[model samples]
Target: MTVSSTSPSAQSSATRTQTSAAVSVSSETALPTSETKQAILTQPLFVYNPEYIAFLNKSLATRSPEEILEWALISLPGLVQTTAFGLTGLVILDMINKIRNRRQLAEHPVPLIFIDTLYHFQETLDVAKRASEKYDAPLQVYHPQGHDNVASFESHHGQELWKTDADVYDYVVKVEPGRRAAIENNAQVLITGRRRSQGASRAAIPILEIDSGVTPAVLKLNVLADWDYARVWKYVQENGVPYNVLHDRNYKSIGDWHSTQPTAESEGERDGRWKGEAKTECGLHKDYFKMRANYLAAAKKRKLTESTDFVLVDSEEPSSKKIDS
Candidate 1:
């Protein structure tokens, strides 16, 4: 979390008080202990509590990056460690490596998960390999089902499903696969690479959150939610962390191969991705209700199509029951 010092008089008269006051914005207030956090997250109304956000804000405002990570180490369990093939995630992964090397935490290290949409740049995969080997952390990669590679996927589902009908694509390719990973791993919590200064969607994102989706049974921890992009880059450089080299090409945010691009614009960071689309997330981190609604809608459509196929087949063959009648 990013800790800042600001007083009412600092803006108006810094010379008047001769004293500096710092506010505690560490990400430690949500859950003091990992076990306690696990228990509280499963409880109802954990997401809606006003104090929860306040605590997150305070923690991020006052704590250092290392301190925030320590809080995560002790306060998050059942953690589904994740990476986005981004610089920030790589930095966090490096820190996580240090934590695991301490021997005690290594015994119960957080499991790593990567959402392999098969649309990633080759460099991304290479970096993933390097990070895994260096940390010796078991990394699990989740890909869209029923296909071995992107070529087969595109051939069957069409090349533009993500563009023409994004929601269905998101469900089948991203959300469903991610949910499967969580369920299979019995993940009661998830870790992500989200930061607040990114935009309005994440301006108030907490360091720790109770993910009340599908089931109010999982927690989501954003360890570096308060770190800015500058800090992330600095950490990666200092640690010599392995990261996607595409960031150098102006791809501030990277995703599928076809969807990702290089942007030279000054204001936009993720704009180079999914060009001209308003979609930031691919539904993995979206609300559970929204994901369920999309999934149900797609399922209903599939059922209708199946029913039509059955009727057509019957009409062509002539039903034995009708003949008997």
Candidate 2:
């Protein structure tokens, strides 16, 4: 599963060629504004037309995951894989490695982005490190802003913040970090691990989707959207991909430690995640605008409460001083 690294000189030459190609395309395109032209030159070319997207989904529905991935590597620029080191994600990572080998690529064509969330199990983190090294994939890890460890996070946000305010907690830990990772990496197309077998919102996902939730909307490629749990597992076992050891303990879908649990064999794959709650997809896949709005509102209310408490405490201190005098 090793993809050799390209020489620095070769990478620079490739970059220059890509930049020149983008400039040529921008010149030919009749963009209305200079800003639009600049954007086209800087970002990967993607058509947001609904008709084209629909056609792509219809055409790709019957393709194998490997075929879909190979197509994506060639067609999509700024491509990256976002994973939690889950089984399905591991399978995709392995497949991408094989594809890179087949194409005789100097390095893994697609990079990987992993949002730590600062609350994942130790086993998950271990798998992330092991998988990245084994696949020789470029891995970029992101976590919540200003908080490196659980203790620091708790000191500011309070203990068990998920229980106190689930939405805010998720926004700070997972959604915000995940968004930051994509933006920082300039990712235009994201290879995700979601499959229809997971059920809920994922049951009807298309092979390709325009995720307009982020500031700069990105393409979400569900290469394995049509794959089932058994198929995914088979690939994992056959490829000997590294995965979270918790899966062997019946923890089907792993996320934050507090919210995740082991499920019964009869339960759905994601039943272990957010147990007893209706939250299937974390804020990462939800409407980014809505999540941001909710987080800002909650933050504002908390700040106001803190300010009022400070005023109350200051007034009480004056009264206590007067009494002492």
Best-fitting candidate, scored by lDDT: 2
Model 1 C-alpha lDDT per residue in residues 1-325, reported as the tens digit of each score: 1112332221223521211122222333342345664575466431223333344546555666555665555544456666756877777777777755653453326657777777778989888888877777767776666554778777656677777678867766777667756665546667778888677577778876656573233566777887777888888888888878888877777887888899885756667767787877767777756875765676576552221111222234321111000
Clashing pairs in 2: none
Residue 323's lDDT in candidate 2: 9
Local accuracy of candidate 2 as per-residue lDDT tens digits, 87-153: 9899999998887676566666665778777888999988888888898876777667666678877
In candidate 2 the C-alpha lDDT for residue 273 amounts to 87
The TM-score leader among the candidates is: 2
TM-score of each: 0.73, 0.79
Report the poorest 10 consecutive residues by lDDT, candidate 2: 316-325
